[model samples]
Target: MNNNNRVFLVDDDTDFRESMQWLLTSAGYDVVSASSATEFMEIYQGEQGCLLLDVRMPGINGLALQQLLQEKNVQLPIILISGHGDIPMAVNAIKAGD
Candidate 1:
């Protein structure tokens, strides 16, 4: 039942990542998580999936990650959620993902 799209999440917030992982798994979706862009890249494996990510992390924020992924042309569907002030930045994220 899980792994339908193999949801991949990368966020610096450990609590949020764990909570989302639990929720997604309970909903019968295979969810993989990473705390940083580096960690996510380590296991990325060029797989196709849906990605849920935060915008500003310690290193390689979501925008930059979108660039990296675009370079590889991995074709991953990404959803970016940022804080209050990051909304404008998140708009850029949408363009980058495109």
Candidate 2:
């Protein structure tokens, strides 16, 4: 499979992550999953693709991980997913991209 076709899925919810992985795989996307931002960081090796990130993980939240990725200049695009999200959080996520 092409490296660019991979999807890095980072979420604390085991069920959600696995479900997404299964769905994406069924859709023919190469999916890589981790339970937390910390685990994602530990396993990620500069792969080129999108990041499907959960917004409320334990160790590092999605926003924090996005910031860390920015600091490290890792250019993977992020799609934030939150079961409970507010307007401020949405605003912050948008602003962070700037």
Candidate 3:
């Protein structure tokens, strides 16, 4: 994929967030990490490019966040990552709605 302008990442896992933040930043992609859906939304508003969203989180999950994005008419490309337990939900989320 082309080098995007930015990547908004939201996950409650601090270690994972930090690691991925480091990796993406080192790769020269402007990266922002969020610990919850609210944080993601805040960052999303400021982002100029794509997004990387985690499926499970406290205070509103990725699926719900995706819905919120749609309702807000956000057109950014979003990549979703989820644990095994969230697989079915994630699949449904990817297929079923906006």
TM, every model? 0.88, 0.95, 0.82
Across 1-98, the per-residue lDDT of candidate 2 in tens digits comes to 69878999998888888899999999989999999888999999998999999999898899999999999999999999999999999999989977
- Model 3 agreement with the true structure over 1-98: per-residue lDDT tens digits: 44466888888999999998999889888887889988766655544677788877888988788888888878878888876655567678778454
Indicate which candidate wins on lDDT: 2
Q: Which residue pairs in candidate 1 collide?
A: 3-30
RMSD after Cα superposition, model 2: 0.9
Q: Model 1, range 10-97, lDDT digits (tens) per residue? A: 9998898899899988987788899998999999887667998888898798888888888988788998877654656867876786
Order of candidates by lDDT, top first?
2, 1, 3
lDDT of prediction 3: 0.78
Poorest stretch of ten by lDDT in candidate 3? 39-48
- lDDT of each model, Cα atoms only? 0.84, 0.93, 0.78
Each prediction's number of clashing residue pairs:
1, 0, 0
Best by TM-score: 2
* TM-score, candidate number 2: 0.95
**RMSD of each candidate?**
1.8, 0.9, 2.9
| Residue 43 in candidate 1, Cα distance off native in Å | 0.5
